[model samples]
Target: ASRCAKVRSSDVAVLELERPGSNARHRISEEIARAISEDKAEAIVLGCAGMADLAHSLSEEHGVPVLDGVVCAVTLAESLFKVGLKTSKIGGYAAPRGKRFAGMFAPLSPAG
Candidate 1:
């Protein structure tokens, strides 16, 4: 809230997710609607990748912009790439420090 307030002033209301998995779309939508009603928020910001596909539909159903982080990221990256804007190789851009894995996560090791 403080970080965003530095650039733009707004009310930040944190909504919690009670359920999990892709099957929680309707429940999530209900929660979003509830939040909007309670907070009088102008838009819905989806916090999960699984909610990407529901963005447009939810936006239309709720009469407001429903933004999904995954979709926004992909769209922004594609737009940037099209305009020849590449990511800067500084600070957080460094290559991942690989590590070993065990048990059921062994297949996800860097060696693989």
Candidate 2:
């Protein structure tokens, strides 16, 4: 509860599910219904990747937008690729300088 409280704000309410799993569809729906009626949440975002399959049905059931992180991530990646936007390779994600690859990975070594 403390963690949820720490992340909660006036605009965002973080509600935890009692039973978090793909099989807990009924529980998840009930929790989302509570958030809608009580907290007045306009959209629902599933917290677990395992819940991705339920987003569409839940949205239809609750008459609100439901988002899955996996789908959102893939969609975002597609949009970024279409726009020619890519992750910068100069900072934390930069390949190691002067690194040598041997064995089956020899061809993957970055050019100096």
Residue pairs that clash (backbone atoms under 3 angstroms), model 1: none
Lowest lDDT sum, 10 consecutive residues, model 1, at 3-12
Q: Which candidate is the best by lDDT?
A: 2
TM-score each candidate: 0.54, 0.59
Which of the numbered candidates is closest to the native, going by highest TM-score?
2
Q: What are the lDDT scores of the predictions, listed in order? A: 0.68, 0.73
Q: Please, what are the lDDT tens digits per residue for candidate 1 over residues 9-76? A: 12222232334443355666676677677766777777666556778988998898889998889999
Give the poorly placed runs of model 2, Cα more than 4 Å off: 1-23, 88-112
Candidate 2 contains a number of clashing pairs equal to 0
Tell me the lDDT of model 1 at 26.
Answer: 63
For 31-77, candidate 2 gives per-residue lDDT tens digits of 88887877677787787776677799999999999889889999999
Cα lDDT of candidate 2 equals: 0.73
